[model samples]
Target: MMSRRQIALAAFISPLLLSTSASFGADIYPSRPIKIIVPIAAGGANDATARALALDLQKKLGVPVIIDNRPGGNFVIGTGAAASAPPDGYTLGWALSAALSLNPLLYDSLPYKPNDVEYIAAISKSYQVIAVPGNAKANTLKEWIAEVKKSDGPAAIGVSSFGGTVHLMAEDLGDRAGFRVEPVVFRGEAPASVDLAAGQLPAMSGILANLLEYHRVGRVKILAISSESRLPLIPDVPTFIELGYPISAVYWNGVFAPKGTPKSIVARLSEAIREIVETPEFRARLAAIPDVNYINGSSDVMKALVKADQDYYGRIITKRKISLKN
Candidate 1:
C-alpha cells in the first residue's frame, strides 16, 4: 500500500528484524534449566550415562541439566514425552539405539517416529557381555555352549528387558551358536543380576558397565564380550569375535530433541555436547568403564547410524520372527 521506496525500506528492515530475533533465540537458548529425559529406570546403564552427561553439560551450559526417568513400555513412554515437549531445545531425550532402532520391528505401533526427533550426538557405545555366577561349572564360552546343548530344557538367559539390545544379542547368539536358550526378561539389570547370582539363571547378557562392579567382586564370570577386540577395562576377557563368534553390536546413547527444533539450536547443543565429550576428564571417566567408548559425530552421522541399525534390526526381527510377547 506504500510507494516503491517505502516498500524497499520495509524489506530491508525485515531481514534485520529476523537477524535480531535469531540472535536473541541463540543467546537465550537455555535461559531456563534443561530437562533430559532418560527412558530407563534409575540405577540402570542408561540412567547412569544420562546422569554423567548431565553433570558435564550442566557445567558447560551454566544451567541445571535435570534428568527425568520415565521407564517403561520399551522406551515409548519417555520417548513420547520428549516428542510431545515444546521444541525449544530445553527438553531433550537420551535415546538408546535399541529403542530408536529395534523397537519399530518388535512392536506394531510406537508413540513417536524416529524422524520425530532431531539427532544431536552420540555420547557412548557399550559392548554386551555374557556372564555367569562365580560358582558356575562352565568357566568358558565353549563349556557353556556344551552345557546348553546337553541341557534338556532351554538354557535360561536373563536379560534386562524385552526387545532391547541385550535381548537381540541373546537371540542372535542362540541362532549363531547353534544352541537353544530361552530368554528370561526382567524389569531391570539389578533384579536380573540378583537372580543370576542366586543360580536361578545359568547365564545373562548385558552391558559390561552394569556388571563391572559385580565382576570385580568375583561374584560373576564374564564368558565373552560382543566387541571387535578386548576391552581395556577387562583385558583378560576375550571378544565374541575372537572366540570365533562374529557377533559385534555396540549399544549407543545419544541426545535428541523433538522434531521442528531450530537447526541453530540443534547445532549449538551438538557442539556443546561434542566439546564435553572430548574433554580429558570426560574421556578419563568413560574410559575406566569396561567396553564403553566415546563417540562424537555430526547430526547426519548420528541419523545414519540410527537408520542403519533400524533397518538391520528390522530384517533380523522379520527373518527370525522374534517376538517379545507370547
Candidate 2:
C-alpha cells in the first residue's frame, strides 16, 4: 500500500529516467563539440564547403564544430571512419558523390557499405565543363572534335582524381562525342591546370572550380558546360545539350552521419543546414566556386539520391570496366 505522494513521485521519475538514459542518444544534442570529417585534403571545394558549413553550424548550434581531414585511400579511410562512428550525431562526414555512388562499384572492399550511413542533407552541387588552352585553334566543341579526330597520340584529359565522376564524365564525353581520352590523374586540379596552361595537357573536363582561374586568365578556354540551360555567370558558354551532346549529371556535396543516428537529432541538423543554405550570404560566398546549387532533402530523399547516382554512374563504370580493386 504505497502512499499517494510516493506513487505520483515514482510515476513522474520513471519517465524522466527513461528519457535521460545516458546509454541512448543525446538528450540535448550538440551538448558537446561536433567533429565533421572531410575526405579530401584541405583547400579544395569539399574542404572549403565543409569549413563553411562548420562555421554556419557553429553559429546555429552554439557549439564548437571542428573539421577533421582524413584524406587517404581514395576517400575510404575518412568516409569509412564516419560510417563506423557511434550512431550519435557528434561524428559526421562529407558524403561525396564519388564515395557514395562510385566507390562501391569501383573498389573490391570498403570498410562500410552505402547503407551504413544516413545522409543528413545535400549542401552543394557542381557541373562539369570541357575546356582547352586559350591559344588552341579549336574555338568550339565541334572544332575540338575535329581536332581529336586528327590527333596522333593518346588524347589526354587531366582529371582531379582518378576514377572519380570527372573521369567518368570524360569517358562518357568521349563515348558520346566519338573521341578517345586517356585520363591523366594529377594530385588535384591545381597541378592539372599547370599542365593544361603549359600545353602539356590538351583538354580537360571537370568541376568548373578547377578550371575557373585558368579560364579567366585565358590559360584555358571553356568550350561548353554540361547544364541544360546557359548559366547567368557565363551566358556565352553554351550547354552541351544544345550542341547535340547532352551529359546531364550534377555532382553534389552531402552531409552524412553513421547509420542509426537518432532521427530527432538528424532532423534538427538537417533543418539547420537547410535554413543556412537558403541565406543570401551563403549564396554569394559560394558563387566564387561555380555551378553550385543547394539541395534540401529528407533522409529518404538523400537515400534515393544516392541510389540514383549509384545506378547512373554504375552503368558507365561497368561498361568501361573501371575499378580500383582496393
Candidate 3:
C-alpha cells in the first residue's frame, strides 16, 4: 500500500524499533521468576545462605526467587549448569570457593572454567576450625602437631570434601609439621562432626558453626580457628596464625551469572545484594548462623578475592602436588 521509498524506510525503522523493544525488555528484568542454582545439597550452610538471600532478593525485586539445588561433582554439576544457561539474567548461581578457585587448581579439565561464570556479588564467608575428639590427649595445636609427628603412620583426619578449603588446609598443616595426613572424606561436615564427637574420627577440620555446639558441650575440643583473631563466641580458641601457621580456611559464597550476562543486570543485582546484606534484619539473620559473616562485597571485590584465593591455593596445591582427580 506504500511507495518503494516508503517501504524501504519502514523496513529500516522496524529493526530499530525491535532493538529498542529488546532493550526495554532487558530493563524490566525478573518479569518472571529468577532461579538461583545452588551447587550444594539443601540444609547445609551454603544452601541456607542461598535461601536467605533468595527470600530477600525476591522481596526487593518484586518477583519470586527460587533456589535450585544441584549438588554433587564438587559443585561442577550445578556450576556447569549455571554456566551453560542462557545469559538472560534469569538464571544465576550460588557459588562457593571450590567452584571458583579450588576446582580449577585441582582439576586438569572441567565442564566450566573460572571465566565461564561472572561473579556478581559476594554474600558471606564461613570460617573453619581444627578440632579433635573431646578425650584426645593433645589440647593445643602445637601438642597436636607433636602427637602427629610421633605417629607411625599418617594421621586420620576427617574432611567434608576433597579439593575444598578444609582438605587443603589440613594437608598444608601436615606438610608443614612433617607428617602425612590421611583425609577421610565425608558427605558433609555434619557427619564428620558426628564421628569426631563420638571419637570415631581422630581429628578433623570443619566450619566453626558445625563444631561450635559440639565444642560448647565438650564433645570436641576446637584446637584453633581460621579467623584472623579469636571469635567472641570462642575467644579462648586461638587462630592458626596466632599458632604460627599461615593457613586460613575461610571460604566465601557469592552470586554468579553466566559469562555473557548483560553488565547492567550484573550491576543492578550486585547493588541490590549489597543493599540487602547491609540491612539490620539481614545482619541479624546472618548472625544466627555461627561462623558466617556477611561480607556484602561488590563484583570487583569478589573478583579480587577470587584471584587472591587462586594465587594462594595454587601455590599450596602445586607445592604439595595435590590432585583432586586422583
Candidate 4:
C-alpha cells in the first residue's frame, strides 16, 4: 500500500547501499603502510631488488613500503616470519627462487610450505657468473679449470651459503668438469665478493648484476656467465654453453602475501606490481643490468613458475642427495 514515490526511493537506496558496502570492503585493504620482509641481508641482490620495487610500488599505491631484513637459515627465518603474519595485504615477502623453489629440497624441515603464500609478480630474472680476482693468471674458464686441476689441494669456491643455488652450481661444475670444489661459506655475497677480490678465496659464483660494479672497476674478472646466450652489455664474455659446459638456471625475484589474504587485495597488489614492472624506466634499468631480464606476469603465471622450478630442483636435489643436514 506504499506510495509509488516510496517504492522508487527504496529501489534507488538498495543499489546505493550495496555499492557503499562494496566500497567499504575494498577500503579495508591496505589500511596502513605495507611491510616487505627480505630474507637475505641488506645490500645483497634480493634486498636491492626489493628496495627498488618497493620504491616504485610506493609511488603507485600511495602507501609507504618498509623493508624488514631477517637474514638467516638460508631464507627460512624471514620467510617464516612472513608466512606467520596476518593474512592482510600489509605484510609481504620478497620471494626468491632459492627460497620458494629450492629450499624444500635442501632442508628436511621448513617452517612454512610453498603454498603458504599467495604469489604476486616477478620483478626480475638474473643470470649468474663465475668470477676470479682481477690479477688471477687464468684468463678463461678453460684455463681456470686447468689451473684448479693442477693445484695440489682442492680449489676453493666461495659461496654465500651452503645449499644455495650457487652451491649447487659450483657442485655441478665440479662434477661435470672432474675438478674438486672446496666450498668456502660466508654470511652473504658481499663478503664473499670482498674475500674473492682480496684473493682470500680463489673464485666465487654470483649474480652478474651484483658483480658488475667490481667487473667495471677491474676488481674482479668474470670468467664465464651461465646463460643461454651472451649478455649484450658484455658480449665479449662467453657463456658456459660456448665454452662446452652448458649449465643455465634463472634466478628470479618475486613478491608474495601470506596465504588467505583477500582476493581483492591480492589483485590490487598484483596489479600494482605489474604496473611497476611494466614501467619504461624500470624495464630500462633492469635491461641495463648485466645478464638481468625483467619478467612481468600475472599471479597465476608466477605461481606456475614457482611450481615448475620447485619440481625441477627437487629432482636434482633428490638424485644428488644434496641435503642441508650436513
Give lDDT: candidate 1, residue 244: 89
TM-score of structure candidate 2? 0.91
Give the Cα lDDT of each candidate: 0.83, 0.83, 0.89, 0.82
Off by over 4 Å in 1: 1-23, 287-291, 324-326
Overall local distance difference test of candidate 1: 0.83
Candidate 2, residues 75-192, lDDT tens digits: the string is 8989999899998899998889888888888988899888888879888878888888888999898898888878785568889877898888888778887777799888878888
- Tell me the deviation in Å of residue 83 in model 3: 1.3
Q: Measured by TM-score, how close is model 3 to the native structure?
A: 0.97
TM-score of each: 0.89, 0.91, 0.97, 0.86
Residue range 102-154, candidate 3, lDDT tens digits: 89888888888878887899999988888999999999999998898887999
Q: Which candidate number would show the highest TM-score if scored against the true structure?
A: 3
Model 3 residue runs over 4 Å out of place are 1-6
Instruction: List all candidate RMSDs to the true structure.
Output: 3.4, 3.5, 1.3, 4.8
lDDT of 4 at 54: 85
